[model samples]
Target: MFWVVAAASAVVLGVAATLAVVFWPKYPALAFQPLADPSRVAPAVPITSRFAAATVRGDRAYFASVSDDGTLGVVAADTGTGERLWGNPAAGDADDWQQLVALPDAVVAVSAEDDDRRRMVLLDPGSGKPLWDRVIGDDDTLLYAEDTVVLVDREEDRLLGLDVRGQGRVRWELKDPGSLSGSRTTTVLAATTPEDLAAPTSAKGAPFAEPLDDDRRIVQIGADRSARVIDARTGAVLVPPRQSVADPDDPVVAHDGTLVVAESDNARRIVAYDLAKLGEPRVLYTAPDDNTRFEHLTPCGTDRVCAVQTTSSDAKTAQVVAVDVAEGGRRWAWPLPDTNNLVPVGDSLLAAQNTTPAKVSLLGADGTVRWTRDGVAARLDGGNLLRFAKPLSTYTDDPSVAGEHLGDDAVELGPLSGVRPATCAWNTAVLACVADEDFVLRRFAG
Candidate 1:
């Protein structure tokens, strides 16, 4: 009887040990660590208001609150103390604060005054006090901003550089600048017509959508196909305007401090001209064959640019080839046929697949595929790796985001089961999401 009792006890202990080993927390190294909880700050947004949007600037998180009275309020929350301030920082009494853009020390809130006029308000991060308010044309868009200058498209025909420090004053205006959008990391923006911004087939769409290697110079193209590179900071013309572009296939791209334009005489040849002197066109890359074409010319790393080469044959194969900008030769090639976008996260690359199920791969600096996750949609936003279990559908489903710092081995992004990440906004410092009409702020420890 003693022996039987001992054997039963040992069996129960063994089973418990096995369960613990198998059920250990997974993805603990790939997630975010929340610094606050619901009980601390409780809800970041008030219960009386619906959480419309949220953004993080500096050390504070801003929330857009919509009340039943049909008024929108900009609320601030202290990330350090988990304190949601009562001051609703705003300028005009616009009905909707449609967008919030975070800068170094201020937050810019854009609201539509009417169908013909749009208002932009720059607010202080601490007290939500108004620093500047400017009413722009309805056709104008807040294209790109850096430091103190906010670049905008004026009346769909010009570039307006507004000084944030000067209360949205027009520091510089470039008339007839054509359609120009700013790059995220670089000042080199593609100059195109207003119509090309909406059409991809025109070879003028998504110029500012990709990251650039440098920001010292900006590339501007005219409607007449003339291209030039200018000083990004001062808007001083560096390369004289020349009809250097070939056709729709060969566009002028600012890369590696050089103007990468196609040889005007030979549409098939591509060259890079140094910004110091537009002396001679250095051969950067050329068409591998007539049947293959390159798409999405992006800067993958320092002194390196990559493009997706797709074969037009029956097989329809695609591969990414990285070009050594210095050597003017191929560095490495990786076969990722259905690649949707090659997003640069710090020094690594987050390769997203355009397939139905969505295969996401984290590629190392040397083009090595470190890890790949299937059946999940992924995005690099605010320099954070955001992921969804399935395709996000706001109409039919409530999608949640599981995110983490791209380079760190952090596991999970706080406790985000009830939060809506689609409407959430994040920066390098903080993440703000909504849960059941309230705002949820999650911070990361560096």
Candidate 2:
């Protein structure tokens, strides 16, 4: 009897331990945190009308100001203290629009003029003081990724890479038209210091995260119409991602420090190259015959790339397949004939299908549809999805279904019951919005 009782107790204990381990809840990386109740907070600048542009970087909020007197300028406010850091109502274009981008080191003001002469101005991030100004043709653009700005000077016929951490110093400038295309990493040719690993991995302003990558390179089309990936930090030409020439018209895409592309034109194989392991490009997918084709490629979830393929001319043959980035292997696949678009937000993906009022589906990391809704307009801001009762307009006037999307759960923000966040800038921790023609700031986290 003693042996029988002892064996029974051991069996019961083992079953209990196995049950506990099996039923435990699973959570993902960078899990969503709940937002506090909404409260009326003061904005950094006086709001007389809608702001032309608004951006948040690091700790400061920058907005284009419009006064009753028709004066136009840029305003900077501290998101933490709710105090006005600085304001300049007479800088850049006085009568036109000023596009503001608050970089960690400097604030940029772009003149959205009505003509081809576009003006670019840099300002001190803290003091809101003007640093320098330049005029470039409308075709020229200033592109910054990972704290480095590339000035594609068409008029000067050169590609100049400037460090955003310093006084816009030129780290490398290549006047050769052939080396002007493709994207690259850091090197010594540009004579830049050993790569700074401490640089913030993503561009600050737009909440559409850029895959948190250090692919500090520019994708340019050269005079020979060939793709050449140039090291934006050093003026050196890095190895071409593929031996076969990529189509000049087709753009090269970078996701999570990996480059994904199909060869130039009418290619069947889809290849992905890890930037660090440039010598080896992984073949993710290969079509068996000409009937199969790549419909599109989209960044999915946190570390997967979704490739939509069609096996035949029949629309029913289309399907969505997920590819694991680091592992370089196919993970999941499901048929979806009307795959309109898929954009990754935080760890989830916001998907839209082709319809009159596009159907919205929130996909999980493993390509599962966490939630789906119809006839509703969804806005992807910060790490949350702002669900409006109706499609959002220029300025929202309705209460929204607001919170961070945590897989199958939400942020549980109850007090956002009567707030409109359509015209706001959010970056995980805080949100600054235009309310009642008044500027207000709201905190998302403790």
Candidate 3:
């Protein structure tokens, strides 16, 4: 009788454990903690006086700035120790070092001088030694991905692909020209074919097709709202220029190589073009006409993309919705008030609010808020970590300081008295900031 009772109790406990495991809600593994004291924050090598732009690749931080003497330059520094690695003091006569493309082994600096001459300089990442420099016409645009450098030459009406590490050897050139109509902005999106996506893995764990010379495609969107898709290897026109849209904003490549374009017509809708068949694009999804507008679209996960939708012209009232790019359906939607930006941080999304009493919220993939921190202006670093700041006062004459926080912790870094907004760059291991007259770089404590 005792053995029979024990057996029955064991079976009941097993059933209860199974039910708990099956019904439990799973959440992302992300947490926020208070930052350390500001006085303890370390400093990295001082960059040029006025910082224009900065980006991090690997362990180096590349910055474009104008010196106190009014000269434009590019500087590379060790992100960990604030040590100066290389400096280009005379990048250009004009103070327009617009873009820096950082790769694993090289950094390409793009500069437009006063003569409208565009220059592309490839430098060794470690030594800062110039590998090669090329001068292209002012109308040309440069884009880099993996080991290939793509140049959209508007003057010649051609798209050129060259080996990134080679001596400017042309891999292929395709002629697909369209006018920008004085529009200054153009975007190039690189994608792989469906077969390449499913190719066997190489020894390095990347898809075997990734290293193939001819497996990529380039989609170029001009300022005039015209777009073209070109084969990267043979310069073949996969999709011609006639597939232009009337109102095109953000063009993102889906995982399956579909070019997704958000078009705002009488009604806002998402149109997708299969790169394999650049014919008539199919409407992926459409927004119901209720003052609805789609602002931006970004990758959410493997199968879906997130779109920031605003009900009115006021950006302060916005909601993020995840849409299935392949199946054409809404997955989830989350409301965010006063949203300044929506950045994907790790497996979560960080919604930064721009209004008074600024707040940052971490959102899960399932549209749940994991945590929220107030009284801070936050931005995502290159590594997707959060860097926060709080202004001391609005009065410029006041000597009040802006408090800086590395994470969600309460510990403040040494305050920057009199600096209203401090520009910063951070990775998982280090935080570099320019506050008032100081450029400080501090390491993260384990």
lDDT of each: 0.55, 0.55, 0.56
Highest-TM-score candidate: 2
Question: Which 10-residue window of candidate 2 scores lowest in summed lDDT?
Answer: 185-194
Provide the lDDT at 192 for model 2.
Answer: 13
Which pairs of residues collide in candidate 2?
181-220, 181-228, 182-220, 182-228, 183-229, 190-235, 247-264
Summarize candidate 3's per-residue lDDT along 1-446 as a digit string, tens digits: 99999999999999999987887433211233333333222122333444444455556766555555544555677866677677765444344555555666567777655476777877777776667777887777775555767887766666788776786778887654444354445566666443333222211112212233335667776666667777665567787774465333463554456777777666577777776666787777788775777765655555566677887757766887777777887878888866655654333556666677666676777878766776443323211243344433322222211222222433333443332233434444444444443334445433
Candidate 2's TM-score reads 0.71
- The positional error of residue 419 in candidate 3, measured at the CA in angstroms, is 9.8
Cα lDDT, model 1, residue 331: 78
For candidate 2, write residues 318-413 as lDDT tens digits: 667777766666787777666655555545556665655656666666777777665232323324454433443345454433454454445544
Top candidate when judged by lDDT against the true structure: 3
Tens-digit lDDT track of model 1 for 1-446:
99999999999999999998898432223335544454123332243433266665545667665554435567677766657774563454565556766565567777755778877778776677888887777656554434344354545555566666677677665644324533211122643222222111100112212221125455655554556655544556667766544342353556445666544343344567675566667787776666666666665566676666676622237676677777797777788868756655434566667777767777767777877776343333323465555543322234444555555553444334455444555543355665555667666444
